[model samples]
Target: MQTEKIVNHIVSWLNNYATNAKVNGFVVGISGGIDSAVTSTLCAKTGLDVLCVEMPIHQAESHVSRGQEHIQFLKETYPNVRATIANLTPVFEAFKKEVLMEGKQDIVDMVLANTRARLRMTTLYYYAGLEKLLVAGTGNKVEDFGVGFYTKYGDGGVDLSPIADLMKSEVYALGEYLNVAKSIMKAAPSDGLFGDTRSDEDQIGASYPELEWAMMMNDAGKQETDFEGRNQEVFKIFKRFNNANKHKMNPIPICEIPNKFK
Candidate 1:
């Protein structure tokens, strides 16, 4: 689709979904990443009331600053965009202290990181309920489906996912077309769940482009060598992450029993 069409389509989708669902507006967690920036911008374009909340849990100052900057842009450019900052560091610290055990730093770290996502999820819903809004998710195709790189019931719990079909590159293109801040478009993507700053590539084992390529190959029923005709490392990492996180991607399975109605 053309850039203008893509923007119009997404904006229409947002508006139509809200209208059909009988919701008042959208609730988006602005994480200062390109995905959130693009998603929030699209939400703002719908001309519905949008609450962009920046929930930081001991995240980098750069992350918070960028979030605030994007919120400012939204407010200035769109009349319906509203934003606020929610500090979640103390809440995370309390959970850490309550759950920490002896000789389990690694386990605690992983659990705590996921807790950050869930905390933000809870916070978003809290505001959504107050305003009769839907939680608009920020995940793109590769992370949300190909690698399942989202915390279940955390960032994964949302009323709508407008960009779940777009690849990371597609998202970047949309971000640029939407006139999102260049700093956000250029900055490394991160979840900001960990206290220490780590890009998404650092944690995901492969970059978004590589993951997207691997997904394309996988969907085409091609072997690892089929991806760019040589490099299988990317495909290998993609499979590892996808297989391990399949539970997040697939809907819960249910058993069936035979009936005698025939």
Candidate 2:
């Protein structure tokens, strides 16, 4: 994938985009995940004002530690990089108190999990507005386009996505090239929205490599009838997610007014 060339390209793209937008820099939410680590590093490479924000809400210890480690690494390695901890736990708790919790347990949990992501999104934009920085997205191809694994108007809301074109494996390669912390690079891929140890594989019922393969097959016009056994299972999983989350992938729909009526 020409890791070195891709890194340079993304860095240059980021710098040019910020300059054209007249923004001082970027603000990225650090989640202690591979995508975020690689993304923040790319922003730092641009030598612009990169602010890495840690907004944890009942986050697991491992996630918190990895986030801190990466933020520290960025600060030590790049003079333009700075970090802050928003610690949105209290805000989250207060919000829960004010909202209705009446629903099926699983549904309620799902809503709250998405709430965590939205809260973090708000935090990132707040910093972006205050610092005149764009909100840099940390999504990759699989999550952003293939499975729609992120929260809409939450993690999905961003001013720019530097790595959205790269697949998960490619993002890992970039992480290795960027010298992201070993802890983060080795940790299981997770959205960290549930505040638990369940990995993305657990939530999606398919590992990234499996999903990547499924995405490719789908792109090539393959169908479920063409696969057998486990392959069929994976394909079904991928298709289910892709179909269910089409809303996240497609542009928001608008009701067009008739010109004659206007």
Q: Indicate which candidate wins on lDDT.
A: 2
Model 2 CA RMSD to the hidden true structure, in angstroms: 0.6
**Model 1: how large is the Cα RMSD against the reference?**
2.3
Instruction: For each candidate in the order shown, give its overall lDDT on alpha carbons.
Output: 0.90, 0.96
**lDDT score for residue 116 of model 1:** 95
Task: Using TM-score, give the best candidate's number.
Answer: 2
Error of 2 at 179 (Å): 0.7
The TM-scores, one per candidate, come to 0.94, 0.99
In the predicted model 1, the residue pairs found to clash are: none
Clashing pairs in model 2, backbone N/Cα/C closer than 3 A: none
